[model samples]
Target: MSEAVRPGAPRAVPYLRQPAFWIVIVLLVVGAVRIAQIAALFFGSFPLATLTAIVMFGLFAVPFWLLLAELDFLEREPAGLRVLAFAWGGLVATSVSIPGSTALDNLIAKLGSPDLAAEWGAALAGPTVEEIAKTLGVVAIVLIARTQVNSVLDGIVYGALVGLGFQIVENVVFAIGAVQQAGLGDRVQPVITTFLVRGFLAGIWSHTLFGALAGAGIGYLVVRRERSRRRRVAVAGLALFGAWASHSLWNSPILRDSFGDSVPAVLAILLLKGLPPLLLVLYLVRRAHDREAAYYVGILATVRDPGLITESELRALGSGSRRGAARRHAAASAGREAKLAVRRLQRAQAGLAVELSRGSDGAGACADRVRRHRATLAALGYPEAVEGARSWRHTASTVGTAALALAVLWVALSALGTA
Candidate 1:
C-alpha cells in the first residue's frame, strides 16, 4: 500500500524501509528460536500435553480472530501483518516478557519483605515490564507500517494479537508447570485442567484484552496526527495504565482470599474480577468500529462512485452478520461464483473507501478490483437479500455453538477439578 498524499505531500515510508519492519523481523527470529526450544521440552516431557496446548489455544483463539476480522470488516489489514501481530503476541511478547518479569520480580523480592514480594510482586512488575513489552509489539508494528494502522480499531486488533501471543504461551507454561507435580497423578490431567480454565474460562479477559486497550491508544496517536503530540502521548499513557491495571488485578492474589474454594465460586470470582475491564474494552471497540464505519461510509457516499457501493452494501458492510447474510444469500440462489463475486466486490469497495479516506495511492487498484467483481456478479445475476436482520439459522447456529462450547468447557473443568 503506497502512501496517499495531497498534490505535493512528503512521500510515505515504504514498508521495507521502515525500522519497525526490521524490528519485527529481528523479534520474530529471536522469539522463534526461544519458542522452539520450549516446545522441544514440552514434547519431551509429554507429547499429549504439548498437542493439547496447541489445539486448545487454536480453538480459543478462533473467536478472537473472527472478532478482529469483523472489526476490520471494511479495510482489512494485510494477512501478513495480522499473522505477525499474533506471532508478536504468542512468540515475541512471551519469549521476552517471561525472563524480564522474572528478573524484576527477583529484584523486588530482595528489596522488599517476602510477604510484600509474594503479595505485590507481580502487580508491580507486570504493569511495568510485561505491558511495556507487549505494548511495544503494537507500537513496533504501527511504526513499521505507519499507514497500515489508520484507526483505533487497527490498534486494538494488533494489540490483542500481542496479548494473545503472551496469553497462549503463558497458558502453555502454566500447563507445563503441572509437570513438576507429575507424581500427583496422570501428568496430562494438569495440562487438561489448566487449558479448561485458562483457554476456555478466562482467556478472553487476559493478555488479549490488555494488549488491545494499549494498542488502541497507539492507533489513536497514529490516526489523529493533527492532534497535539502531548495529548496523544497522554492517551497512550492512559491506555498503558488501563492495560496494566487490568493485568495487575488479574494477577493479584487478593481475589483468592475473598472467594470460596468451590468451582462455581472461583468461576464467579474470576468473572467478577475480569468483567469491568472487558466491558470497558468492548465498549471502546464498538465505538471505534462505529466511528470507522461512519468515516468509510461517508467516503463511499462522497466519492465519485455511483454503483460501486450501494446503500445496501454500506449497511451490510457495517455489520459482520449482515455481510455474511448477503454473501450467503448470493450463494444460496446463484451459486458459488456469485457468493465469491459478492465478497470480492464488497472487499474492493471497502478497500477503495479506506484508500480514499487515507488518501492512499492504491485506490485505483481497489477500483479495478471492484470492476472485476462487478462484472462477475452481473454475469451470475446478483442474488441478494436486502432485509436488515440475519436469518434464524445463522443466529441459532452462532448461539448454539457458543452454548455448546461453554457446556463442554464446564463439564471438562468440573471433572478435572475432581480428579
Candidate 2:
C-alpha cells in the first residue's frame, strides 16, 4: 500500500534558492565585508595600496578559481564539506592559533632567557607554531568530513585555501606594521619588497604549503582503511613534521641573514630548499590526472551502448586540445551553442575522469555525473552534437606542463642567483 504524503512536511529546496541558509548568507557577508574593508584600508592614504591589493587578490583568488574549475573531481557532499572545512580553518583555526601561539611565545620569553627566545624564535616558534596553526584547519576539516579529502591534491587545495586566507590577513598586518615602523618615507619600498618576496615566493610555501603537507597526512589516513589506526596516526605525524621542517627552514636565521646581505644567494637557497616538495606535489597531481583519464574510459564504454556518444568521440574528448578543436568545429557548423556544448562536455569528461579515478563508479554515481554533463551540454543548446566530430587536442596537458616547468625553472633560477 502506498503511504499518504503528509501535506505539511517540508520539501527539500535547491541550495541556490535557500537564501536564508546561514552558511550562504554568512559567506556572502564575509566576502562583502572583506572586500569593503580591503578597499577602505588600502585605497585611502597609500598610493601603492591599490597595486598591493590587486596583486594580493590575484594570488588569493587564482587558487580558488582553479579549484572551482575542477570541482567535478569532488562529489557534491564532499565538496560542500570541504568548503565548510576550509571556512572553519580560516575562521576558527586562525582565531585560536594566533592568540595561543602568541601566549606561548610570551610564556617562553618570561621563563628567563632572552637569548633562548631568539634561538627558539627562529627554530621553533615560527615553524612549529605557524605550521600547526595553519594546518589545524585542515585537520579539523578532515576530522569532521573525512570522506571529502580523497587525494593529496584535495588536501593541498583545501590546505592552500586555508593558508592563503591566513596569509592575506597576516600580510595586511605586516604591511600596516611596516608603515608604522618605517613611516611613509620608507614604507613603500619595504612593502613592495615584502609583497614581491613574501606574497609570491614564501607565500606559496608559507601557510598553503604547510597546510597542504599536513592535509596530505590527513588524506592518507582517510583513504586507507586497511592500515591500523596507529599507522595512520604516524602518517599524519610525519606529514605534519615535514610541514614543520619546511616551515622552520624557511624561517631559519641562516636564510634570514642571506636575504639582505646577498639577495641572490638567498633566492638560490629558497629555490633549492623548496624544489623537492614541489616536485612531490607535481608527481601526485599528475598521477591523479592520469587516474581520472582512465575513469572516463570506463564511463565512455557504458554511455556508448546508449548511443549518447561514440568510442571514437570519447577518445577525442579525452584530450583537452582535441576538445577545443571539437568546440571550434562545432562553433563553425552549429553556431555558438554548439561550441558551448563542447565546452560543457569537456568539463564533464574531466570531472568524470577524476571521479572514476577516485573510485566513485557505481551506476548511480556514474548516472548522476553523466546527467549533469548532459544537462550542461543541453544548456549549451547542442545536446545532440557528436563527440568525435573534432580531432583530439593536447592543449590542456601542454599548458599545465609548461606552467609547472616554468614554476620549477623560476625556483631553480632563483636558487642559482642566490648561489
Candidate 3:
C-alpha cells in the first residue's frame, strides 16, 4: 500500500505555521487574565489598602510605561516579546523570590531569633532575593531570544526594564501591607512619602540598576563566547555579586541615622549609589555607538562610498538633538516621508554594519541590507537624493559637535549642584 498524505495538510507549510504561534497565543491569553486580576486587586476595594496599592502602582507603573513609550531606540522591538519580558519580571520572578525569601527568613528566625531575622532581613532579603528574581527575567529573555541581544547595552536596557516592572508590582504589595498595618488616616502621609522616596528617588537604584549590572554579565557571556567558558562564567558571577552588593548597600540602614530625612541627603544617596551604574551605561552606549559607526564606515569604505555617510553623520545620529535636526532638515529639503526614509536608512545601515563586523557573510549581507534600505528610501520618495550623496558634511558635523559640548556642560553643572 502507498503511504497516505496527511488529510487537509498543505504540501509546503512555512515555519511560521508551527505550534509556537499557538503557544504564544495561549500565553497571551493567560497573561491578559493575570493582568486583569492584578488590576482588580489594585483598584476594586474602597479600603485604604487598595488606595495605597494604587498609589504605589502609579509610582512605578507610570514611570516604567513612560520610559518604555519614550524610548524610540526600541521601536523595532516586537510588542509581544516586550510584554512577555515584563510579565516574566512582574509575575514569575516575584512569585518565586517572595515566597522563597519569606521561607528562608522564617527558618532563620526560628533557628536563631527574631532579632537575628530582623538584622538579616535588609541584608539578605532585600538584595539577594530581589536582585535574583528581577535578573532572572533578563536571563529568560537572553536564553529564549539570544540573537536579539546584540550588545551589552541591549542587555542593560532589557534587564532594567524587567526590574522596573518587578519593582512596580512589589511596591504595590508593600504599600498595601503598610496601609493594613497602620490605620487609613495615619497611612496616607507615609504612603505618599514612601511613594516619592522609594518610587522616584530610590527606584532607580533598587531593581533596575541591579538588573542592569547583572545583565551586563549576561550580555558579556553571550557576546564574547570566543573567550573561555570558564572566564564567561566568572564574569557573569562577578556581575551578579556586584549587583547584590549594590542592592545590599542601598537597602542598608547605615545611612538612616546619618542622613535622616534631608532631601539633599536622599539625593546624595541616589547620586552616590545610582549615578555610577548610569554612567557605566552611558559609557557602554557611547562605545557601542562609536563601534557601530566605525563598522559602517569600514563597510562603505570598501566600495569607496565616502559620500553616502561620513564619520560626523554617524556621530550626529548618536545624539538625540542632532538626529532631530537631521530629520527637520530632511523634511524641509524633501518631505516628511523622505525624512522618515533617511532615518530608516541610517538604522538599517547601522544594523547591517554590526552584522557584517560579526563575520556573518559580510559582502552579501551588506549588499542585501543596502538593497533593502534603498528600496525603503525609494518608497518614501527619496530614491535619488539618498544614493551616494554628500549631505553629511555641512549639517551633521556642526550639530553633533554642539550637542556634545552641551552635554558636557550639563554634566558639569549637575556635578556643581551636588558639590
State TM-scores per candidate. Answer: 0.85, 0.66, 0.68
TM-score of 3: 0.68
* Candidate order, lDDT descending: 1, 3, 2
* RMSD in order of candidates: 3.9, 8.5, 9.6
Q: Give the local distance difference test score of model 2.
A: 0.57
C-alpha lDDT (0 to 100) for residue 219 of candidate 1: 81
Better of 1 and 2 by lDDT: 1
Each prediction's Cα lDDT score?
0.77, 0.57, 0.60
Better structure of 1 and 2 per TM-score:
1
Model 1: per-residue Cα lDDT over 60-87, one tens digit each: 7788887776677776767777888888
Cα lDDT tens digits, model 3, 177-230, are 565466564346545555655665567567766776787787677666667899
Scanning candidate 2 in windows of ten residues, the lowest lDDT window is 1-10
| lDDT (Cα, tens digit) per residue for candidate 2, span 1-419 | 00110011011324454433454346435644654565566656554755564466456656754653353232222445455545544554555555666766666688947776766665566666767766766665555444455554556667666666666656655665565566654246556545656675565556666666776676666655567899988987898898788776766665555556354565567676776666665565555434434445555556554334556557656544455567777787668777876666555554554444444444445456566666666666656445434333445667889789567647645653453
Clashes in each model (backbone N, CA, C under 3 Å)? Answer: 5, 9, 0
Model 1 error, position 334 (Å): 5.9
